[model samples]
Target: MSNSKLYKGSINTIILKLLNEHNKMYGYEITQKVKDLTKGELNITEGALYPALHKLEAEGLLDVEIAKVDNRLRKYYKLTENGTKETANKLEELADYIKTMQTLINPKLA
Candidate 1:
């Protein structure tokens, strides 16, 4: 599958989990971090990422802080308390999804 196609459904959960682990991250930093963490298996484009970030922020699951970093304004995103709880739920859901898919894809193995 194409990188975007493969990860479309899981991006939000990945982003949330990353923020849960790191506390806070900016947009580019988040993308780069995901690339690093996944060993390039997932490549998140700006077109896809910023919208999700904005949506999450709008939904009150995220808090943004604007700060100067090396003379450039950067918006950092951190999960709110509600976001943390939501992330936990989302992670569990993702785990279950993976298990289900695995079973469906290789029922003989199971």
Candidate 2:
């Protein structure tokens, strides 16, 4: 399976979890953080990342702030009030999904 296809469902949860931990982050910073955390195993493309961010913003789950830095405007994202509440729930859901996958892969472990 393609990496994007495999990861298509969990990107929102991943982004929420990162924002939960870091308070705020910009797009490229978020991408690099994911790569570094995963030891380069997962690569989040701009094509995927930006759309997800936009969707989350539209859903009222994320708030954006713009800052002028080094002659460029940077947009940073942080979880909104609803997003903060949803982040915990999403993390739980993602964990459950992981456990289910593990159980399917190893019945003996289950």
Candidate 3:
């Protein structure tokens, strides 16, 4: 039973939440932050990350800016106005989902 399957569904929310907290972040930075926060239990792949970013950007929930650092162009992401609203909505939704899952996993805790 891999935890990846469990986390896959929530990746978007995770990304949005991180951006909300940090103001802005690059893709690799996002991946590393998650891994560090999870104590290496979770690893976010570029394959899963970039496509999600693209989708979010396309949906107008995210804004991208390019900066040249160390002579290389790096793309950074930040939440747009809509994204900030969406982040709040997603976080509330996630809290509900987690509560439901917790009740299912342990009725005594409910």
Candidate 4:
């Protein structure tokens, strides 16, 4: 993200939401997809992304698949059952956060 601090807290939620929508994705693919979806307004870096992935895996919110493509192994991530549920909850929380922030920023938006 261009303004990563503002977005850092939502990285896991973002990852889960994207995995929910796309089913499965590799690390670089996830980065590219986020970039494309946000029109480059957000950029997920390796420093930020992998640790989040590992954390989700440790939390049992994600599953990893390893596949060989032309002698190179690639790691793909997908949402687990718990992850699906979490995604919905996180999205709702994010939406509510946006609404609250909007209200605070501009009471007319409330």
Candidate 1 segments whose C-alpha is farther than 4 A from its true place: none
TM-score, candidate 1, is 0.93
Residue 34 accuracy (lDDT) in model 1:
84
Cα error, residue 52 of model 3, in Å, equals 0.4
lDDT of 1 by residue, 4-109 (tens): 6758888788889999999999999988998888898878989889999999999999999999989989899999999999999999999898889889999986
lDDT for 64 (candidate 2):
97
Q: For residues 30-73, write the lDDT of model 3, one tens digit per residue.
A: 99999899998988888899999999999999999999999999
Q: After aligning candidate 4 to the native by TM-score, how far in Å is the CA of 92 from where it should be?
A: 0.8
Name the 10 consecutive residues with the lowest summed lDDT in model 4: 1-10
User: In model 2, where do residues sit more than 4 Å from their true spots?
Assistant: 1-4
Error of 1 at 77 (Å): 0.3
Error of 1 at 55 (Å): 0.3
Candidate 4 whole-model C-alpha lDDT, 0 to 1: 0.93
RMSD of each: 1.6, 1.6, 1.7, 1.0
Clashes of 4: 1
- What are the Cα lDDT values of the candidates? 0.89, 0.93, 0.93, 0.93
